[model samples]
Target: MTDDTVRELIARSNRLGADPRNTNYAGGNTSAEGTGIDPVTGESVELLWVKGSGGDLGTLTEAGLAVLRRDRLRALAEVYPGVDREDEMVAAFDYCLHGRGGAAPSIDTAMHGLVEAAHVDHLHPDSGIALATSADGEKLTEQCFGARVVWVPWRRPGFQLGLNIAAIRRENPEAIGCILGGHGITAWGDSSAECEANSLEIIRTATEFIEANGRPEPFGPAVDRYTALPAEQRRRRAAQLAPVIRGLASTDRRQVGHFDDSDPVLDFLAHAEHPRLATLGTSCPDHFLRTKIRPLVLDTAADAPLDEVVLRLRELHFAYREDYAAYYYRHATPDSPAMRGADPAIVLVPGIGMFSFGRDKQTARVAGEFYLNAIRVMRGAEAISRYTPIDEAEKFRIEYWPLEEAKLARMPEPKPLATRIALIAGAGSGIGRAIAARLAAEGACVVIADRDAEAAARVAGELGSTDVAVPVTVDVTDPATVRAAVDATVLAFGGIDLVVNNAGLSISKPLLDTTEDDWDRQHSVTARGSFLVSREVARAMIAQDFGGDIVYIVSKNAVFAGPSNLAHSAAKADQAHQVRLLATELGTYGIRVNGVNPDGVVRGSGLPAGGWRAQRAAVYGVEEQDLGAFYSQRTLLKRQVLPDHVADAVFVLTAGALSRTTGLHVPVDSGVAAAFLR
Candidate 1:
């Protein structure tokens, strides 16, 4: 029966969580009581199973449940350490575990246990918080829900609030739920079915109430001046602003960014009152956890000139940091956790929309989504009554809570390339593809750029996710396509940091046999391609004002004199020289340009499939399969170089090891006496 109850609870939790109308992502808890056999006592015991700390309701499993003896959980009140000492109760909960326990219990555990019901659900539905945060919340709750739903004044979730809600539930037997003031909602029932029904009733009722009683334009009507620009114009503007925003937002540490111009976001931003409400910050703990205390609202119009917007952004970013530092000092006590960062997680541009930043793409994207949730709450709150949020000091307390600090401490350390974004220009296959995978493993977001769009997309699919990597087609020789790829990268992430210019073709022929077309094609793909990619990406890197890396995969033949490799070798030499030139020019901007010279990258190389291998084999008088061995035998190391070896050199160059090293060429060849740079 306990197993069955856990299953039913999971199903119900999924249903409630699947609907955004019921709860925001990972912002709710559900629990159920059932009979379990006690091994020690050899008797039937009632157990409580509740969603544990940091567990998401939509995907909750048996492992996500925190099981405890129901009797023991209820008895916690007898030893209740009072409101001021409520945090101690969380520690005491470990002693009440039914057995070895499941997951760590969340702060809302006692609220689920103390209520005299078989089932309970605590959620953060926007509609519920809308009513909860209204200026006249209690009156509004009474009017919206009648006698069936009770209203509790604002109290941060903890042992004391649990006890208060339990008392309310006991006194009002007719009530099915409570609108938790300045928070969300809690519903309880004797059965799972009854609990779900009650939860749905609260959500549906609140939503219907807001729709019926709220003003037509809750945001006080959209200002035509702040309305969304045309799609193409908005995208161009967003791409222009994303890198600068990412660079500023990463003032403390590096951060990935998300650009949002969804209908809801645009609608909210277009309203005249958005700036006033955005400054007040969010009310819910979950919302504020991701959004920070408040967003940095861009003071300029969306369609303003690019130069004006960029200048204002710098001013605003500086002020935001100063204000944040002041906020920390004003409320931080000796016991408070150290300041995390002053950079705003959410940035609002009146006509543009929102830009949210985090340590990773998903986190950044989710932060934007949470701010949208804040928008929903604000819209509803204003239509019926004034928007009221928690006091600023209280927000500080929650933001820097000791427990929150501990949670962050438990998270795994970020990968070496975690916040770095890379552009692998020829990542469809071979050396380029290997570098993409290597960087992805180290936690870099990558853009797979190749002339073969399908091949680029295929490699991107194999690498990771849309958030981790994206694909774009670009002919290295074409300036238009190169610009498009670079712009796509900025739009995909916030900007570019790591770049590998590895696109090249080989035409194995003696200088006498080499045709003009062969020379032009080889140079076009290798020399011209590298130059074009570097030039365009350098612009974005300069605009971001953040130092970056560019690596060219030049071949050993670039320096070593080799027969039947005229066009290929000359183009390779051109790339090698470009590295030195760019490194010299871009050094002032903190951009490091380097080169990797590899010998005979035979395994997993596109050259073999592109007819270069057959030509090389014919010239060497060796069978097609023996070409690898022939190349290896001539090397001092007697080992044929592979794509992975080149990738390793690339990683070392950009992964902070060679931070100060630029205009240098590191050889990835096993060993080549003549090829070694003098």
Candidate 2:
């Protein structure tokens, strides 16, 4: 019977979470209560089931719902002193758990306890918040909900909030729910089904009323349609601006992932009054925790030069940080913990879409998605009147609330490469793809750059992370394209941390037979391409004021002579020497340059199949089938070198295995004496 109730609660929770108009990610919570055996005491007790803190209602399960002893939970209200209850309430909630679930109950658990209902659902529905967060939202709530709803002014969520709800419920015995001013709505009933129905009805009625009362008009500055670029161009512009915004948001020097705003985001940015409106706080307190009370507004035109955009971003960032610092210090008490640095979580760029920053991909995506939802809510509210968020004092209280900060403090430790970003040249196939996959596995965001855009997309798809792996088309031989790719990577992920120059080609011809075209092509990719990619990426790394790594994929032919591989060998040798020169120059910037030399790997090396390997083998008087055997036997280790082996060598260099050992080469040929350094 308890299991059945938990299942129904989870189902209803997911139903509410499914729509953004209902709630943002993990922002809503639902609960059901029943008699159950306490896992700790082994006694039948009255239990209050509530959503655990940080659990997403959209995917809530039994484990995510914490069961507490009802009497113990309510008893906390009696023992608690009135001062600084926010932190005390959190401890009280933990103490009241009825079982060994161990998960902390939602901060709103006390309100659920005070309501005399079998089930309760609390949500930040757009219709409710649209009315609740407006200038005259309290008055509007009474007008829309009538006698069925009781309105409660905003207060920090804690035992104190529960007392307020309890007092309101006593006065309005027949009320279906309560509207939390500048916050959300709380609905209650004898069953989960009834509660869901009541919540939806209130939302529907409120939405209809808003639609009838509000008039839609263009609110933003008039955009010059003639100068406005296409949607694709706008998106590219957004990507390019992402890195600058991300750099400004990095208070701890750790790079953040960037999430581009949606199509609806463009509609919001297109408004004339957006400069003022976009910074006027979010729809509810929940949003403030993720997006901050207000976004940092940065404007750029659709056709703005890349350099100009970057400059404006830096200037705006300085201004935003200054303002945020002033705001933080003004509200901070001496007893308060050190204020977090003033890095904007959400950035509003007028001509392009908005961008959200987070320590990882998921958090960044959540902020971006929530801002898009806020845009919808604002549009609805603004259709009737201007958006008026909660007062700055209240916002400060919520933003600096001890309980909310505790949640972040409780987060799991980060991965080794958690805040790093990696860009790989020619990452669509073979060794490049393997290297990309490995880096991503270690928690770095991997940008796949390849001449084959489709293939890059395919490889990125296989990586299966939201913002971690992105595909960009890049032609290594073109200086303009190479520079643009580097910029695009910085825009997507703050700045480049490591770049693998794995894009190369071979010309199987003797010096006498090789044509000018063949020589130019080989040198174009090998010598010139490496130079361009390295130079452009190095600039980004230098600008970030942090050290990075560049790993070049050279060939054994750089050391050993091949029968007819003149052009390819010469180019390889050229880059191998270039690595030493680059390291000497880049070391002052903390940048490390290394080379991985691999020989005769059949699989995943972009080596031509069948007749190509046969022909190469015949150059050494070996049969096609015996080629692998011959190479393995010639090496002292007697092992066939695989693509993954070369990738591992690159990983070691990039992962700091050779932090002080730059300008060096690691041969992945199973110990070839001829290729060994003197």
Candidate 3:
């Protein structure tokens, strides 16, 4: 006879929507049962009943019950191989119960039969499903349940899973219940009421934890209106989503079985920052085996080609798999079983809810349920501290145990330009632009700041094409503008890596003919601008954990002596002194300050212009064409110096290759300064 308490518990499970059977959709399931052994004869007793397939728990009756002799069941388990021995055990139980025949047993009957408690029940609750869907789910579950709960990492159910539980029970007999990593849970007790109570207690704990910690703060005032599309638009968009889903699934004829546009869950997820969405992976590895780590969040209609979407998803999956394999090889033991394969357990379809793959419907349902719970738990825990998933190496060790050799084989490589952000002042043209472009190409996101707005925009546009250039128009001499540009660059790309102080003005005149205004114009952009920009960038670099590189574009006048060009020479010399002082002060912060002194570079063109050639020709008493030849022959390289030559020197100083060389002048004048000194 069916126990009244068992019937009531089943009724409550149905009311709460925990009845798996009735909830079967394209991807869902439910299961429940009662537990007991005969007290007097030590025989198996059917003290309670569970709803069978094709029936809802709310309407279940005694006919749905599958009974077995308690003592006979125990005896069969004592010699059974595990759930793998299901057919044999079932046949034996049927023969033993011939006098009182019943309907077919539930698929999990072997597992439930192994539980030693008097009462037991299991169900894949929706709430539980939502919490098992992210990277932080385990820690979140622990926080919610305290220390009493036993966490079973993802294992396929049936014989293997049952064996896993049996082994655990042997070690920790006091475990109140078991929480399967990418599945649901199993509760057991001495009576139907007590088992239900345990289930409810776990559920309550999970719910409270979610209520207290799981929800994300609303992404303050939806800045983008596309996030709040109307209902009709959402429907139209979902139709577009179908094709992408099909392509991601790699099934051309796949149809949408159900649509959930009104889902607040989808809306909230759609509005989340791109970074957060990119980082969302399944809560557990078992979920990885089925749903993969992340899903494709789509909003477009199902009829679109979806080829691009599918290709992107495949690329992400391949990357994740490669990362996982690398990690496995890093931390695995030489002989662990987890390192046996390279297949990923989950695949996240953008715009659609998670899709779980398994050997059959039951396995898929369990995986999906577990992923859902991971998501909810991770979302909750993010409210406390942003959930940063463990790196691929740590995850690899957990996923595969025999591949630790991979991580140990490689030497640690330093960053291409460690602790350096290169800012190119007056980067709109000539030497400044060339230096900025070269620095950015070398893995630094360059900040191009110039007084000319159009020139700045043009240079920025050119640099942006390569993804590492950011342009800002700022009059370098203005302290406010200099500070703003520095702040903006740091905000845009984390921190300052290097500073290329290339903004300066030049004028040729005798010392007696130079005016105060000429000196002021030259010094303001060269000496004062370089000093202020260096100070600001240096301050920012020191505030950051990593230090940086600073290079000043001084003139050859500071050393080899330019024609008594009063204004230019005086201003450049002052800038050289400022660079030395900066080098000393910023040394404590690991910032290296240096100078690049280039000679005869025309203001607009990197090469010497016609005017510059004529002037040089007059200085050396030769024709303009002969001047180029004259300078080219005088240099060790036998070639006129190009802006790129100066840029290359700037790169070496900024990059860590010359970490030990700082506060020194690097002249890219083809041994011209050496000739002068001689």
**Sorted on TM-score, highest at the top, how do the candidates line up?**
1, 2, 3
Q: Residue by residue across 171-251, what tens digits does model 1's lDDT show? A: 999999999988899999999999999999999999999999998888887788788898888987887888899899988
Candidate 1 deviant stretches above 4 angstroms: 39-42, 608-610
Any idea what lDDT model 2 has? 0.80
lDDT of 2 by residue, 124-170 (tens): 88878777777787788888878898889877677788778878877
After superposition, candidate 3 runs with Cα above 4 Å error: 1-415, 460-467, 602-630, 633-637, 673-678
lDDT of 3 by residue, 333-371 (tens): 656564443433333332333344332223334455545
Candidate 3 C-alpha error for residue 173, in Å: 39
- TM-score for each of the candidates: 0.97, 0.90, 0.46
